[model samples]
Target chain A: MAVSVLPQMKQAPEMNPVERLMAATAADMARVNDLILDRARSHVDMVPELARYLIDSGGKRLRPMLTVAAAILFGRGQGHAVNFAAAVEFMHNATLLHDDVVDESDMRRGKPAARMVWGNKASILVGDFLLGQAFMMMVETGDIEALGVLSAASAVMAEGEVFQLAKTGDLETSAADYAEVIRAKTAVLFEAACAVGAMSGGADAAGRKALALYGLELGNAFQLVDDALDYGGQSGTLGKNVGDDLREGKMTLPVILALEAASDSERAIIASALGKPDATDLEVHQVVAIFNRYDTLRRTLDKARDHAKAAIAALDSLPDSEMKTILADVVQHSVSRAS
Target chain B: MAVSVLPQMKQAPEMNPVERLMAATAADMARVNDLILDRARSHVDMVPELARYLIDSGGKRLRPMLTVAAAILFGRGQGHAVNFAAAVEFMHNATLLHDDVVDESDMRRGKPAARMVWGNKASILVGDFLLGQAFMMMVETGDIEALGVLSAASAVMAEGEVFQLAKTGDLETSAADYAEVIRAKTAVLFEAACAVGAMSGGADAAGRKALALYGLELGNAFQLVDDALDYGGQSGTLGKNVGDDLREGKMTLPVILALEAASDSERAIIASALGKPDATDLEVHQVVAIFNRYDTLRRTLDKARDHAKAAIAALDSLPDSEMKTILADVVQHSVSRAS
Candidate 1:
């Protein structure tokens, strides 16, 4: 069965819910981030040099930005939302640093990884430091709901990574398992980012639910397309090499489905390739060829579009606002953008 | 300038404070752990598996046990001290798993490292999962004071690892620098554990400070003796391999002093030895002989004794209670034990 891609949002700038929501509260969001970075200075002094090294590396600040954006979408433009956003970003960065160490990865955002430059121990500990900072920041917010949401999301994120590790080389991973992993590892934070934003703004039940759904769907769309791009060349768009996931032995959507449909010989090749810790680039190329033969890349792209459309539908239930329109643009970008 | 070892408390079975404290909170602590673990089931299903892998791996669970002991000692035994203890233990294990991955260590507690068993990614992510579990457990305690203390301590622990990494193999590291590292990496948690225990038991400011100091000194003593035993080669008492620190290129108390006191030729030899992390056991033995010649091992052991006495002194201002007295005994054990 072929799935249709969502048409690109041509009037996205004018109609995007996320953009409208963000435009309304961009200044406050910036202020909240400044406050967070200021407070982060206290605990960060223990490794002043390294902490500065990472903080200066420049991040997208997407999680916190989304948190603030969600708050504005819910008609809540307050400082607490910004604090929670900063905390969310801290948690995200902590994981990134730790992940880099665990993966023995050398680069991040075209720069040397914290571990590569500072050594693995520094990266690992600094990651832990960021996590501690996150909790402390959340506790000070004094919102039991926010604390519950963030902490619970963090637990899921950790669990998701462990689950992914356990299943990485296993070709038997199903679409459901893949979906669950994305939810646990990525989307839950997105959901919480919006939920916390709504809570901070004191949104109505409908508003809260709508923002949560929108964030989840958007995250799903983003990760699904990400998985697909690894099977096809999308470096110009995604800023990463093609077949990176296969090289990492990740049982992502295209690979999982393609393997399911593989001929006996193809299956044997994949099974052997997946078993190894470091699969060769030639093996990755062979896997990508199998994906192409099965139209696996196209199928995954279709799923991503479905998720993006579902995300847009979620916003349809919310009060029509500028922030809502920007959100629509975000969903559009999730499946369409290169990087 | 021989440093005298603290006399080990020669008490009857009934006089064993560690055992007594362990017994007092054993059931409640276990039950509370059940509660925290239950909450984790839906959020972190992989945790039960990972926790079993780690907890069954023969770790002493010393930190959590001390937390419970401290709670009982402070007379605030009715609350979530057990969960707090469990949280601290989880944090400690997280560090262990990540540390093994960072150091590329093959052995822990006389067994294979987690990375060796499950691979680096699994070890790292599982470590992260344990940390998240710690945070989740802390959320259940619902005490901001306890939350703040643990959070700050966690950050210090991370920073300490970075500082330690940065200073590793550097001959210029001072005693003050070494002290700061241990304090951040190990003692802060010990201090926080006791402080959280006091908070749990509703202990006053004075009581909390006293216990915190006691734990801090105990940690310092413990680390100092640990370093000394690495050089002293009193294997019967230290259980761990002698000069393991030197083999790992770790700069410890004896080595720091030895470098300072060495003749220029000897200093160059030491520096060159540290350059090769893959040094043979014979090479390690050669380094130990050098330390022996300089009396660096003896001097370091003396310094450890001083810290042990200081640890006991920190408890002197506390109220006269059996638990308090037992805590003092533990402080002495901190220095006297071989491993």
Candidate 2:
């Protein structure tokens, strides 16, 4: 419950690139918190209660900071970058509220989710309000091109949510199906944030395309890692329990791919575990053990690493800058985050 | 249950002056039914079961017809009026789906609501998908001003929903509060549609302003009439029972205003009916008798007339054409709809 405020340039732990990346993320996230988020939230008190409640509950703020970093990398580091950055963050929170209602999630970021605090109806409406506000803020940019990207991304995000709703709990789902879901649900906004920043900063079409590619790959990797963690990572480190995805009956990429490669007996056990009215801890442990023997975690991590590398490759066209380094660092960190 | 198609030239008997003005509205409504609503629902076959479940249950396409009539009157008589009109209708449907979930209503338009058929979670997500699609359709307009106005209105509508959530079941509501609620809940988008149509047609600032004014007044009157009817409109006519609003504890305009005007004995009776766990038919009848004695319905209808006149006044700046005449007719007809 104790919140710590650490300096930006903290030392990295040995043997884990995650520490350095977390430290960088912490620094960048802090700037967004201090500069834009806190200020915008305070401007309107009543509704911002939920916005701040969701935002400050220890989210990575990776998307908004990426927008800022992208702007800086492209040599237009000031002006609407912060605003657009907040807009992206708001969009993320909006999705989270609706997702929690849809998923019936009670906790998020180690705190009770919005639906838990305010009920599903409030959470849903507030989520809608946040999305609208995000669009309104983006309109202030006066750049129709940016508007087009963000609006389209917003549409894609909603579609992704519906797609997930349609697909979740279905045993027939494949890794490709999961990939499609993740790409729309999580990655598109990240891609939009970076692309909008590049385009807004006057990046050429090729540069904007490259940035978008990097963001998409990076976001995909981040979600892949998240899916893997949901399947096997330590609860203490991950902020979620291993096998949470199974209990929720969600067929994430790792689970689907692992199921594809599992032996008949393993698949039977997995299916039975998923079919439980309320999956018991022992059943979850059994499924986890099967996944462990198959090295599903390792395979998932490797795929995530490949995506991260692809993200880095996408950034090769950018002129070297502090932000570019940070952007690349974010991709690595995204894949490595335990939570 | 049988519907008879009426030609524009041959008006129905009960049609008033406003209905006469809105003759083209009837035709436009039919056009919308064919070109947009039917096709839009047909495309829902992609989801097959869920789509069939939602669209097969009928909905009144009031919002879209309003848009079409306003657009035509405001000089947007050609080029994708159907699309924009459908966009508004889609928005209306989206709101209805979400409202059913929030209100936990079982029936709408004489059948099971979307949530009742598919579950609240699906209805909520599909509502979101519909809303997103509406935005996409609006974007297809390529009118920045139109986008801005609709986007702003959408935001207000979301905020209104939130406001309603925040105040739900609270009996301390006032007439002014109720007005504020309706303004956000129903009027803004109506205003935006007229504004967008005028703007699209290259109407001057005065003309656009007039259109907006007309929309605001008409929407206000329409909502007021709806609330009044909800209090006592015959089921055979309005397809709704009297006292449904009171039973739901909606705190609508007539009830709020009526409560303020109630004598001490009347207030006690009204309070008892509202406070009861299940208000009996006799209790509702008593409340209705009190309302009739207080002339609450007449007062509300008078206010509606004032708004109707104001909407007509707002359109005075537009060039006099058949479409303009029809738009004016819509205002009169909207306030007088029996069902």
Candidate 3:
């Protein structure tokens, strides 16, 4: 459990990429956290209680940090970036809460899932509450264009969830479909977070586009690494069991590639294990054996490296700053975590 | 089954209040409906399917009509009222979708609830989608003040729901608490609907205040009538069974008043039925008998009548117009439905 997501980065003599980024944006992110917790307050006790349970549950606040770091990278924001950062985090956490309910997850961040403790209905409603607050925060920023970006992402995220739901356990789900799913559900928010942050910093259109593209590619790499880690990491290393994605019928890159190369007998073993909530450990071993044989985990990591490279390349237009170096390192760490 | 909500108005041989209002705003309401249906479209099949299932379900588009009617009263929206009206409807349907999931109701509007058909997870996510789309519509209007009104209402409505959830079946919930709950959960949206419509319509400060007050009182009266009808009306009268509020442990005004007057034996019976989701029909009848003994339904109707009167009184500041008359009449009809 003490093993960080990017253990190698922790071993680096310099500060970890995530830690360096957090330190760079520490002041703004602190303000954003305050704004988030303040907005989370409501006369209805349960609204705040359920919301803070997840907001305070040690999420690394990575999305909001990106917003803040992007804002600082561009220069001093007019101060609206703090609100946008908080809004981004709220949107991310809101999706997570609802996702846990949809996936019927029992744990999150090494603790009981919000749905497990509060029930699915509460989790769902509270998720709606957080989303409402997110919009409220965005409106406070008074940037209609930024609001459009976030709202569009919000809609696409829900679509991604539905598409994923429809494709659950289907071996026929293409690599392209998985890409579309992750792009919508995960990358859109990241793209919005950085784009809005750039806007708050008075970045011109070109800068905003560059930051958005950077966030998008980083998000892609982050998710690809996460998918790979689900298969390769030790239990509790990722706050879930290895093969959890397979058990949940998620069509991650590793599984997609493994299925592509699997022989008929190996395919049968994978099919039986995929999407079976009660998939057994031996079945998982059999699937992993095939995954190892085909080196699909390495292929997945390779795909993540490709995304990480593109993420850094997307930052080529940005002016040099200490934050820029950390941002590129963050991209590298996103893929390195899986390795 | 042929009974209309405003039965007394129907007896007058002219168009009933809702019909009159809808006819008055026919052109605008049509545009609003088109916008709503247009916004509901998505590449994700279930997103539109579940969203449309509820939007197309049989219920008067009362909230959107109120928005359009309010806008027309002041007559200066420049077509933005259509957007606000569509946004209002989307918000209302979004809440209904989530409410059904939280309450676990099997039916809505004479058909199976979307949750029953599509399951709770889809209902929740799709509801979130509608909410996101609602905000998008509102932002597109470029009305910043109006956006704030709706977003604030959005947060308050969620808080209201949480309060209602917290107080469910806690028999000692006071009349004041019940009043706050309904005001937040039901009336704030109504107030916002009209206020935003008036804002978009360019209503003067005095006229906007009057419309907001009118809408709030109308909302209060409408919800009180609904609570009374839940116990007093026949099955299917309100797209649900009699005593559903009791079975769900909703502390509606009628039940709140009844509990205040119940004898110890009656109180014990009500307690057993309250929040007991599996309570039988016989149990409902027993609770209703006690409600009859206390005249709680009548008292609830009387309270609604008081609010309806206040609603009409609030509209006195509005200059005379057909829309003004119909709006006042709509207030009366909101209560008369329970009669």
DockQ of each: 0.47, 0.42, 0.63
**Residue B172, model 3, lDDT:** 94
lDDT of 2 by residue, A98-149 (tens): 8888777777887888788878887877777777777667766666677778
The most accurate candidate by lDDT is 3
**Model 1 quality (TM-score):** 0.89
Give a tens-digit lDDT track for model 2, residues B157-236: 87787776666556688777777878888888788777766665557788778888888888888888888887755655
Docking class of 3: medium
Runs with alpha carbons beyond 4 Å of true place in candidate 3:
A1-13, B1-13
Model 3, B1-339: lDDT tens digits are 112322223333477888888777777777888898899998878888988899999789988888887887887556688899999999999899889988989999999999998888788878888888888898898887888889888888888888898898999999999899889989999999999888878898998899899889989998998888888765656888888999999999877888898889989999999999889989999998988888888999999999899999999877787678889988877888877
Report the poorest 10 consecutive residues by lDDT, candidate 1 chain B. B1-10
Scored against the true structure, residue A278 in model 1 reaches a CA lDDT of 71
lDDT rank order: 3, 1, 2
Poorest stretch of ten by lDDT in candidate 1 chain A: A1-10
Query: What would the per-residue lDDT of candidate 3 be over residues A1-339, giving only the tens digit for each residue?
Result: 112322222334477888877777777887998999899998888888999999998889989989887887777558689999999998999899889988888889889998888888778778877888888998887888888889888988888888888788889988998899989889899999999998888888999999999999888888888888888755676688887888999888888898998899989999999999888888888898999999988988888888889989989988777778889998987787766
- Where does the lowest 10-residue lDDT sum fall in candidate 3 chain B? B1-10
Runs of candidate 1 with Cα error greater than 4 angstroms are: A1-25, A32-59, A204-206, A269-286, B1-17, B32-47, B234-239
- Colliding residue pairs in candidate 3: none
lDDT of 1 at B74: 69
Q: Which fraction of the native contacts appears in each prediction?
A: 0.67, 0.41, 0.57
